[model samples]
Target: MSNQKIYQYLMAFGHFCSDINQTALTALLPFLIAIHHYDYTTAAMLVLVANMVSSVVQPLFGHLADKFNWVWIVPVGLLLAGGGIAATGYTSDFWQLCLAVMISGIGIAMFHPQAAKLVNLASGLHNRGTALSIFAFGGSTGAAMGPILITASIALFGVQGTLTFLLIELLACLMIGRYYRALTELNGGSIKAKQANAQATQQDQWGAFSVLCVVMFGRSIIYYGLNTFLALYWINVLGTTETVGNTMLSIYYTIGAICTLFGGKLADKFGARNVLKCGFAVLFPSIALLAMTGNELFASALLLPMGAAIHIVYSPTVVLGQQYLPNRIGFASGITLGLAISIGGITAPILGKIADIYGLTTALYSVALVPLVGAFLLAKPKD
Candidate 1:
């Protein structure tokens, strides 16, 4: 393969490693609830804490990435991400668990902006959507695998099985370290060169970006809602085994991973805004049906369309965000990849509360409404 392809794959591998830890936390939630006797809101708060920290720090990290070449953050962040989740197994208090999760969140925050900045530089303009989709695919696949890995680990070693993430991350760090020089070389030169080039280009379109943010925010809520509760929905509402519920979750993410790549190619062909509109259009009905359905076979069948609708917009949004703010690619990436996405986690507790007071079915129905709003926003004249 060419150096560019190799570098993209390497970065994608890093993305996979980083995201596994993020999803690992989600996968661990049921176990946490069962083992610790925690309520729904308390368990969801773990996601909140992680996303809150990531949402707060990712922009700062992205700003730093814009100013300097922070290539070293990748491996360091991977280590911390893996290590933090591993520490979760050992925590004795709620505060301690939150602290460990916070560390993982920070590590995740550190990885995205810099890594995405490098991916953008490597892909250039023509194949950006495809390249980013590949990168996103890796994370999505890792997300798919996370539940299986964690659940299998727990089956074998109990909660302490989270330590497996530490070993996996260490291996990823060493691999990335080995390729450290190649990664910098892919940057084409110093951050100053990139900044100078950006300055000479089209200006940032704040209005368009604001609209994109709304689109992304809606997508985030739906994505996190399904991700956080799908397994529980299977277990609690559908009367499936935990193993079966998590397996369905794995299938959901695996389908999303495949669609993520397909979505990028579609974006390249049809235009990002069109792809964004198409995704939300499909998403609204899919989620609405998913909420309304009670049959296990039917719910499982819906995952295919639901996964496609949610992930089809993934790379397109990221690419458009970068295109909209050409001069602030890293910062844009931080917002698109980190902050806008994680902001949904801020609502996790609220969803948890809804689930607590009403039901998971009602909470999911609420999630279905978000995409309708996104579709309305998308129907507006181009910004």
Candidate 2:
């Protein structure tokens, strides 16, 4: 394989490492509630805090990446992301837990824009969708692994098991550092290419971009809603063991990972917009069915199509966002992959409250409505 391929894969691996911590905290939610006797809303507050910080800061980091080479932030962010989550197990105070989660959020904020910018640069123009799909695949796989890893760690070491992510991220940072030169070279190429294309006139489509952001926001709601509550829904509503619940979560993300890879290829063949529309169309019914079903075996079976519907749009959205704002790819990435995505986390507390008052099923049914709005937006004339 070429050096570029190796570097691309390395970036994807780094993404895997960074995202492992993202889902790890969610996976630990049950443990947190049981061990500390926290209520649903309070436990969901941690997700709110983390995503709030991440959503706010990620754009600034992306703007900074656009203005200058900030490749070093990648490894540093990885370290902090891992360290913050790792500290969660040791904290007993709610405020302290919030602070720890905030730290991880900042770390995540620091990592995504620069890393995505580098990946875009490395992939060049031809196969950007495929490259980004690989990147998304890494994140999806890490998300899938989060529940299993945390479950196993907790089984062996109790709540303190969160430290496993620290060790894993440290190794990832070292590996990234070893390839630091290659990454810088890719960034350098991006700079040179920008200079060369200084005379080229590619207009930014803000109107369409705005519409896309709205669609993505709706998608984010569905994604984060499921990520935060699916396991709880399984355990509480379906009368399953914690292990079974987490296994269901793992299955959801594992299928999502596989679909993300193929989604990119399909986008490359068809069109990103077409694939995106199909995804939203599929997502609505899948989520609606999931919300209505009480049968454990059938609900488990639904994860296959549900995971596909959610993730099939992942790479296409990122690629389209960058295409829309060609000059500010990093900033576009921050909005699409970070802000748009993390904003969904903002609703977790609200959903938790709904789940607290009404029920998990009601919260899930509420989540199911979001994609229909996304589908409506997609049906509008192309921006």
Q: What are the per-model numbers of colliding residue pairs? A: 0, 0
Model 2: lDDT of residue 35: 89
Q: What is the lDDT of residue 76 in candidate 1?
A: 89
RMSD of each: 2.2, 2.0
Model 1 lDDT tens row, 1-383: 87677778888888888888877888888889988999889999999999999989999988888887678988888888999999998876999999999999999999989898888877756688999999888888888888999999889997888899989888888888887887776554543366447554777888888888887888888888998999999999999988998999999999998999987888788878888888888987888898899999999999999998888888888888887888788899999998888889889999999999999999999999998876445332223
Q: What lDDT does the true structure give each of the candidates? A: 0.86, 0.86
Off by over 4 Å in 1: 188-199, 375-383
Count clashing residue pairs in model 2.
0
Deviation of model 2 at 205, angstroms: 1.2
Tens-digit lDDT track of model 2 for 1-383: 97777777888888888888888888889889888998889999999999999999999999998888778999889888988998998979999999999999999888888888887877757588899899889888988898899899989997888898889888988888887887887786744477327413577778778888899989888888998999999999999988898899999999999999998888777878888889988887888888899999989988998899999899888888887887788898989889989899999999999999999999999999898876445322223
Q: Which stretches of candidate 2 lie over 4 Å from their true place?
A: 190-200, 375-383
Clashes of 1: 0
Global fold similarity of model 2 (TM-score): 0.96
